[model samples]
Target: MTIITRFAPSPNGSLHLGHALSAIVAHDRAKADGGRFLLRIEDIDGGRSRPELAAEFRADLAWLGLEWEEVRAQSTRIAHYDAAAEELKAQGLLYPCDCTRAQILAADPVIGPEGPIYPGTCREKHIDPHNCDGPVAWRLDVAQANRKTGPLIWEDELAGPQTARPEMLGDVVLLRKDPDTPASYHLAATLDDAADGINMVTRGMDLFSATHVHRLLQALLGLPVPRWHHHSLLLDEQGRKLAKRRHSPSLADRRLAGEDGRALAAALRAGQLPTGISCSK
Candidate 1:
């Protein structure tokens, strides 16, 4: 099988140090194996997705010495997501969720990397009556999902030989059922990976919870599941993971302060990957 890797990023902001490392890993690995590196602008957030931001992403990537053979921005694939949803609904794998965010949040913690793990309140009903009125979200029926618990197994480039379960993930959203909107990140990314033949996915350890949903989607779609690697996150002095919110000083801003390519590249070299894994930055 040909090795294909992708560097997918949402263009809500400029590329940061963490993002730079992820792209370098994807591009270098593909180049090393004589494969292809793909660029995916995960600009599904219609409100936040902007043409200028997209262009800046490309420029920053070029500056970092990372490049791709092809680029695909998710905003243009709304119809594709709709088509994928139809397939899931036909397979009895999807359901309309009338549960508003407020109602779902009222129940208890949803334990997630970002929020409480969903309690799956509408599992039995299959329809959230409280807001069955309109403006629903599409969800995958995890209660009746193929197995009781998914100890999903896959080889990781960074965090190698791992297993994950649903209780740690909960039922994820597939489509934002408004019909006026598009699919969520989990939904769009799995389909894109399959469509682009991206058999390798590399991202931060912060997104480890998302891989379970991605694998389940692959199984449901009969698509080849990609090898996943959740690399360790670069942290700030406080030891908190770097992010746009907490880590205000981005590489973009730092570059504008006269930081050159060599200096920036050196800092990226010091960034860590999941324990036991190392790569030339």
Candidate 2:
């Protein structure tokens, strides 16, 4: 099978160095394997997603000396996500949740890899999907889902084999409360990968734990499984991960400053990061 990889980035902010590393890794990996590279705009957050930012993302990638066989925007695929949610709901694997972040924290939820694992407040209520009144998030009945799937396993290029443990995330939201935008990250990403024929899911290590949940979703949805490459994350001098919210320097900034993008891409390939940036395994 031809190796296919994608760099899926949310267009809520500018593309920073961390984003650069991830895009380069995915792009070069496809090239080295004689495969195809794709670019996906994860603009599902209607409230925060900006069309201008998506256009900027494309220019940033081109400036980084990267090319893609195709591009996918999540905004165009809401119907598919709703269909998947309906299927899961039919199987009794999804439940309505109205709990807010503060409520979950008040319960003193166990802190998981993603922080503050949901306390299953609504899961205990057994809210009837049909009776759910106004704006309520749909959550996966992870414990039940796990029981249905039995033991599951997925492989990471770096971490080898991993057992599926969706419970660690508790009952994660599959659909948000907002009717205009319902699909959650876990649901959309899994469906998108399968739809795009992505056989190699190359991304940063930060999402390594998410693969477990994705594996379970694939089993439940009867989607084809893909191998993953969880590469190292780019961090700042203080060892914190580079983030757009933190005002990390962006690729667009570098481009406007007359820096050679190809040279920077070459340097990144050689593990030569910009000043105060380091890689964490």
Candidate 3:
């Protein structure tokens, strides 16, 4: 079967070296295998998503000499996500959660792979499975969902095959409090990959644990599964993970400062860090 990969980036910030590495890796993998590469803007956060930054992302990719067969944005796929959420609710796998982050933290939550896990405060609350009232997030009841699907398994191109333990991440929010767009990254990404026919999902290793939850969502939602390749993240001189919030130098900034984007892309592919960048240890 032909391999299909994507470079999905949130347009909330500029592309840093880490983002460049992911994009190049996915693009090269698809080209080397004579497959397809796609560009997806994950602008699900209605408040933070900047539509203007999308053009900058395309420009940066082009500067690096990377090409994709198709481009898509999550903002346009709300209906698919809504339908998937409804399907999960119909299965009694999802329920409305009124707990806020502060409340979860205040409950002395256990720290999971994805920060403080929700204590399931709203699990017992009367949640309208069909139509929830008030501003509330929709969380996937991992325990209940697992009971229906039984044991599940997914493969990582690098980490090898493994059994899925979605409960490790606890009950994750599949749909947020947004009235118009309720899908979270977990729900949207799982459905989007299936919708786009992506056979190989390439992303940062920081999200490796998220695959556990994604696997469960795929099984519960009846979507096609795809192999994952979680690559290393880029780091700064201080050996800290590159984050847009920390003001890591963006590809556009470097390019504007006379850096050769193609040369930088080559260095990244060869496992070499550019001037001041390092690999996460």
Q: Which predicted model would earn the best lDDT?
A: 2
Off by over 4 Å in 2: 128-133
Kindly list the per-residue Cα lDDT of model 1 for residues 138-248, writing each as its tens digit: 778865564633455666776677665544567777888554348888889889988899887878787887887777777777777789867666665556666665544
Question: In candidate 1, which residue ranges exceed 4 Å CA deviation?
Answer: 126-131, 148-152, 177-181, 270-281
Alpha-carbon local distance difference test for all models: 0.72, 0.90, 0.88
Residue 8: error of model 1 in Å?
1.1
RMSD of each: 4.2, 1.3, 1.7
Record all residue pairs in model 2 with backbone atoms less than 3 Å apart, i.e. clashing. none
Q: What's the CA error at residue 258 for candidate 2, in Å?
A: 0.5
lDDT of 2 by residue, 1-281 (tens): 78899999998899998899899989988889899999988988868878898888888899988989656699889999999999999999998888888898999989999899998888879776566666789999999999999999999888898899888888889999886567888999999999999999998888888888999999999999999999999999999999989999999999989999999999988999888889896
Clashing pairs in 3: none
Which 10 residues in a row give candidate 3 its minimum summed lDDT?
A: 126-135
82 Cα displacement, candidate 2 (Å): 0.4
Number of backbone collisions per candidate: 5, 0, 0
The stretch of ten residues in a row with the least summed lDDT in candidate 2 is 126-135
lDDT of 3 at 14: 95
Residue 261, candidate 2: alpha-carbon lDDT: 92
Error in Å for residue 55 of model 2? 1.6
